[model samples]
Target: MDSYQENYQEEIEYLRKALAFIEEEVEKEAKNLEEKKSDLIAARKDMYENTIHASSDFESLVDINLHSMQINNYISSYNPQRFKNLKKMINSPYFGRFDFIEKGCSEKENIYIGLYNLMDRNTGRVYVYDWRAPISSIFYRYELGEVMYDTPAGISRGDVSLKRQYKIWNSKLKYFFDCSVRITDEILQEVLSQNTSAKMKNIIETIQKEQDIIIRDRDHELLIVQGTAGSGKTSIALHRIAFLLYEGLNSNLRSNEVVILSPNTVFSHYISSVLPELGEENVEQSVFDDLISEVFQGRFGEETRDMQLETLIHSRGKTSGEVRRQSIDFKGSRVFKQILDRLLWYYAHRLIPFEDVYYNGTILATRQQLKNRFLHNEIGIPMAKQLKIIETFLLKKVHPLQKKRLQRLEKIVEKSEGHEFEIKSFSRLLAIRQAVAFRERIRKFTIVDYRDLYMLLFKNHGLLLKLARGLTLPETNKEIILTTLQNLQKGQVHYEDYAPLLYLKLKIEGNDVVSGIKHVVIDEAQDYTPLQYEVFRILYNNATYTVLGDIRQTIEKTADGLLYDDISEILNKGKMIKLSLNKGYRSTCEINTFAQALLGEGTQQGYASIERHGEEPKVIPQETLEAMDRSIVEDIAKFTEQGYESIAVICKTQGEAEKVFGRLKKSVQLTLIKPRGGEVTKGPLVIPTYMAKGLEFDVVIGYDVSKENYVSDFDRQLLYITCTRALHRLVIYYKGDKSPLI
Candidate 1:
């Protein structure tokens, strides 16, 4: 214990010394700012003296030879090395002829000036602008905007164009640009454009700590970072991309090649300004929902309308239609692709060739006890002999059924028979021949009639309509109506089931819309199923992927089961990595302790982890549900009064959230925050626990903990999410039994 105390004392001493060193640095900065201020004054005075003796035309009157001789004499009189650059700089284009109108020169502000741009006389190309020299002050503030930053030995003010257009060579590339700039977003009559002031405190002379670290680590393909809400995680991510690009230099990576999967449209808007601030163009940004919709376009009406986001807003539940769910699951995962393969096999064996017999409320097919349509005996023979079977069937089917009426129907059946060569021996030949003949017999088609096959599609139109709504049914009266209506139609378009590669042919032979991106990042990765990931893989084939999410936060029932099992399976097993962020940096120390206590041993799961500190967690036992609602209202008002940025009454499900929100909204008049839940508005917000996953509040009041609501495993995630949202404080109020999670 004595040694520990000594170590603590030593740590205090070290911190004290560090503080002193920082103070000394601050003093040095102050001294440097003063020196710069004096230099500005000297330059202004010298310019005033030159103006008094100036010539109307610079080259004709003021002797450049005399100025150079004076600068040379000063250089010889003093240390030649000390004033070399300054001497050369003083004789610049508008050479020491300008004076700053030193009105607003105050503490910490150093004003200076220099020659502006050096343009090629013949080519009119800008060679350089002394933007970094101590001469850019006139362009920064509103004080000296009227005068051109440089002077040609005169005191007369000059007008400068807001934009200067030019073409120049940057390395091997020839670039043209219009460089227009606003200093403080204002326009003046005679705006100055030369040099400006540099405040010492704001001067960044060295790379920042995080920037240095990011620049050095260039090899890691995947970077998993969990940081505090304001800890610059996003800032670093953008910079990391920029640094990789700068290093990629002449290599392959370009600004267009980088992709950032933002959380939402509003979030994309929020981050849109960051990259441009770093002097790099913004990369492609989108939500995972966009990719999902693109993948299921023709087959399903899958929307990036996030199920969780919808549930929160629409007061929904886990989808109740089992068949509909099966369809969604099939399409949303690679399993759907496999199911397509299976269906193709079914089509190949003619298992899908069912005929409606009005049995079991669905169309049914029955197999004949004998060959009712007859069969070609040469079917099982070798390929060479099989050709003979097709040839014989075609010759027989295509033969003039009636030699007298052969002209109209002759070539049609003959041509169709050749198209159905295998079908003739396959028993369906007679049915196809009859369906085709009946079509031609009914319609005046000296043309080829492809209507018989379309009969089945038109008959199933009702089912197709319902399917488009993402619905599945056992059987419906609409099917009968559809069949009756289809029977009345003479000719309709039909789809032929082409073995296993029906829709797949369209996909495979489809044009690949190349997305120009080298890297794709999915922020909430666990919410994606294996199929969504595959679609992303296909869409951005040339891009490396970086996926990030807390699987515990994967509260969507339709997500990767929150087990992340699909991602694990699809990523070739161990190619998938699992990370446990044991330390929670978001909440307060007290809140962290209570939450860990609430979570118990389950908190140790790889999917669920939180920092060790936050506002204290509480359980307020109320008198009744109404009283609980009232208590939350009072607490929310109190939090807002205390300057808490966000306050939410988080509940397990959307239904529960709505009930609580409805009651408390009336009692407390709390603001009903829309999906655009910005910084805590004027009042508290009522939000679903799931919707509040990546959000936080100054205080969160758990609405209830009844046995039916809070103790169930289904509510465990909601509880975790709400508990983690307390940036400063959290309170859980319940009327009945305690929550299991609590």
Candidate 2:
């Protein structure tokens, strides 16, 4: 037989053996688990029935303790996780394999890589190595040549004799490729050419060299990734979490200790399945707005970032929009951060009470003592905590004097002429009244609400001016302040104010750190302002961060979002490394080419397309809105018949999306994706551009690309985001003249 046929026969025999071994192991584990469960149940039953009266005697107590220990042992021994892993491996045990010969040894060993390690208990032989194993790094990082991998002992050098990748489904090898490169482009092209799905899948077998480097990096504490659209930033971040969990096996790192901050709820749902696919549980997922809402206990009405973007998009060129834009810019600026710092200083130095605290004409704590404690004793602490320290000190002083006074009154009452019982009752009532009065006095002086303090910045203009020294305020400063006060009065807060308000709250109320989170992943990092980064730094000071963003995809125009340099400066707690993923993999070359042109000149260098080609994006102009709608319906039908499952009709704003959905729902099956919360369903969908930030589809139809809708430079990113969501086809329909961006 030829070499190809010979290798195929060998692979088939190997698959049979692997399947048989997995089945046997699964049976063994199942038996062990059942025995352990029975032992635990019997032990518990015995302990409950016999130990009811064991506490009454020493010998009985000893028997009960023995039963308890037996139960604990049985419970700890009942592990069904291995059985589950074995069942998962029964169909497809491994995806890649390589034959390696050590530098000194003449013999070669075959290493099979899979989702989890598999071994033979009888012979102590490993059947497969987990993808995150140290030796598996060679499979991803090296070509067919001499390679070295780090082990617990040291570096081990070896030569790769053969490298092969397999695609096995239902215990059958569909195809296998013998590759001479790190990852064969044939496999990647095949994987990339498939249609889009509602949920993202794990890219384990086809991880590129650059992406594998990021996934396995353990040296840097802060990893910043600036990747273009379709560059697999989200995938890299998720795979990194799995690698960390595997590498930290002995260190007790858990899945729940890592948190991912996604763009929104739909995006969170979209990427939730990746970690579990890699044999790890999903980590904690949240958004910045959710964190803010949790901190405030949902007491205040807050505007969302998506809602703010929709307003800005819909109200372009209006006076109110300009005012709101200026307000957001000023609030998210460095000058505003400085102003907050000055305001904190003022609170520490000048906001203290100027009188001594006294009870019944006896001084408890002098004002100077309180000031000394607040300023000098509690150095480097939050002002709110410092005030708490002073309150505690004053209370300590009041307790002894109150006790002495009550003792003296009791003695006087005993010596007075009256019925003894009546006098005692009266004295007890008097003492209770005195105690209440004293506590009320202490409460009055020691309590300070941080909300009231924050409101002073807007209500007291003189204070704001004094704090804002040596800085240039925005031209609409007065209007901004007025708008803020009005929102506060109505129990509402603007989206841009969330960071500043939360930061100020942390400064005054002391940092409420979530100490358990060891790793934090911030997706779409370009959308966050500097102050928000600062807030994250303070809140998760102990966590290592992986921040991914692309500045070319920024759609928010109000806030001055932080770039890489600013982020490095703000979150610089340890060694930081920056990486870029320039290759676009989500869309075809034609789609990427058309989308890159929307970025204008200098920013187009951020991304390069792979060697995939498809139909070029088409911009179709119609005579009227009805005709445009009809054309869109026809195009959707054509794509659907062409086997495109996930199609999106992307609009500029939520209002526009609603109008389009209303007009098209009766004609076609449509699901409208709202800004706040919804599921991303397959098939044709109507969604706004901002809500479609981190999703992809097989076909995307831009609803209205008229100049009247997208009129400014700000809309370029929105249009680019809309077009880049397509994997195979992009169609733009406009009633009037096409947007200049197109």
Candidate 3:
């Protein structure tokens, strides 16, 4: 018997013990669940029967109170989730272990880490520690040396004697390694080499030191991560959500309270499974367009972000495209935001009509008094709240005056010629009509729809010039105005217009803020504009934000993507920290190198790649479109035969993808990903570059990289994003001449 055999035997024995304990715990929890169910049913029956025979309201209230107390007790005490966790543990108990000795203690503790903690029934010995526990930080942060971790009490100092990692499945240990470093490349290399999946995987056992720091960071309210492509920014953000929920850093933090704003619906579904794999519920996943739609409430025909990008991609060099480009640029700029701010000031101060609140013939609140209250008295209050206060004040003043006028009207009706009952009925009807008219006048004076206010600014060019405040307008300002007015006349709102509209709605209404959201995670942050960030800051004002993006992957040609300084200034309400993840993890060394070369020098200074090797990206030039199509089909078949599970033929626009998919559907089975669709599917997929953002494939085929398609500097980011989606293979096919970017 050698050391290997001895260790195997020990592992098997421990597995048996852990399995037995988990089964026992599952049984105990099952019994508790059944007992609670019975109790709950009995309590409901007792309440119903007692309430039916109650003599008075007090007696019924007593019965209801007793039932409510019973229900609360049951809900608090009974947790069937314990059984689910135990069942999950029976398959794979733990993944890593560390031997640690406290500073003054001679005995060492073996800390086994898993998704959830398990304890011995009688002796109260810990069988496994939850990976999110404070002590488990050592496994990700330190090697075999002096280490310390923060706890609720203080810091715990210890010396790590040994660190070990395991790969266990179905209660069987497949492999184990003893390492002196924190997270060895041996494990990461194996994990990274696996085929890409439709859903993302949780990287608990392979979290790097830097990633660990981000996962556990609770000090900063605004965390901005500018990671390169394939650097696990999305993964880090998801895991950080799980960490925040587990730590309960914000007293009773829940998964739903953490909102993740993904780039698209497909990307949202791509990351939906990460939290559940870590034994946490999925957080709220949404896109910016969804938020915009919610705010606008289907009042206008809105264009999606993907639709906007698609239009720009397909409409190069054309007059309408240029006008649309300028429109998006100006609308998404800080100058536009300033103009909107000035417009808001005008609406609040100058545009709104100030009239006296009158009842019948007398004024209840004078115009001067109302203006003083709305403008002077409530200087710092929100416009919506100030309007509300003025309404309430006007109503209060009208009540007494209204009663006196009605009494005088009754006297006049009695003095006139009429039957006794007729006089009474006539007086009552007159009073009702007068009261309704009075309230209507007050409502008309106090309430203003902001949408109309927005429309006014666009309709009146003189007003726009006054609000521009001498800022340099875009050269295509007239075209921008014309296009916007045309869209507005057709009851349509362009995607670029959503941010400004949302900003105005939120600023004036101030009722759209969702106070329940505690943490906000904005993925693909580079695609967002400063105006959009401002809207986010107002909407989730109470939430701590985690923004993740890669500036190099920004493909929105209409506007400059978010810059570090711009975001820092917009979300400056709390402590803001910016971190960068430069190492490429989702791509091979060859693919990363090829993608980085597209950006030129100085861009690769902070970026590094792992030791994964693959064939260099192939650039194939074709004589015609037919040749390019055939080449793409052949490569797809070859990659499929090579055992790649997920393959994509990415194009520059939806129209191109449709044409390619139409041509190839007969030869091979394919999934056509549209700009507006549900979850993304695996296997050979034909998708536009905009739709493929924040997704990875086992093999990617760039269908068209010709000089005609990618001719401008604006197309650089689109080309870069299209190339970096490949994990194991990348092939670029061009018709006629290859792109100058090559």
In what order do the candidates fall by TM-score, top score first? Answer: 2, 3, 1
* Segments in model 1 whose C-alpha atoms lie over 4 Å from true places: 1-217, 220-252, 262-281, 291-337, 341-514, 557-580, 597-602, 605-615, 655-683
* Top candidate (lDDT): 2
> In candidate 3, what are the lDDT values of residues 93-118, reduced to their tens digit?
99899999988899999898898889
**Candidate 3 at 523: error in angstroms?**
1.0
Give the TM-score of each candidate. Answer: 0.47, 0.93, 0.92
lDDT of 2 by residue, 329-443 (tens): 7887778888988887787678755457777688877778777766785357777776676666665566656545645655655565355555557766566456556655655
lDDT of 1 by residue, 653-710 (tens): 5566677777776767765433342333434767655556545456777777655566
Superposed on all Cα atoms, the candidates' RMSDs to the truth, in angstroms, are: 22.7, 4.2, 4.1
lDDT of 2: 0.84
The reply for model 3, stretches above 4 Å from the true place, is 45-56, 356-360, 400-444, 557-562
Instruction: Output the lDDT of residue 692, model 3.
Output: 86
Q: What total of clashing residue pairs does each candidate reach?
A: 21, 0, 0
Question: CA lDDT of each candidate?
Answer: 0.45, 0.84, 0.83
Candidate 3 residue-pair clash tally: 0
lDDT of candidate 2 at residue 442, scale 0 to 100: 57
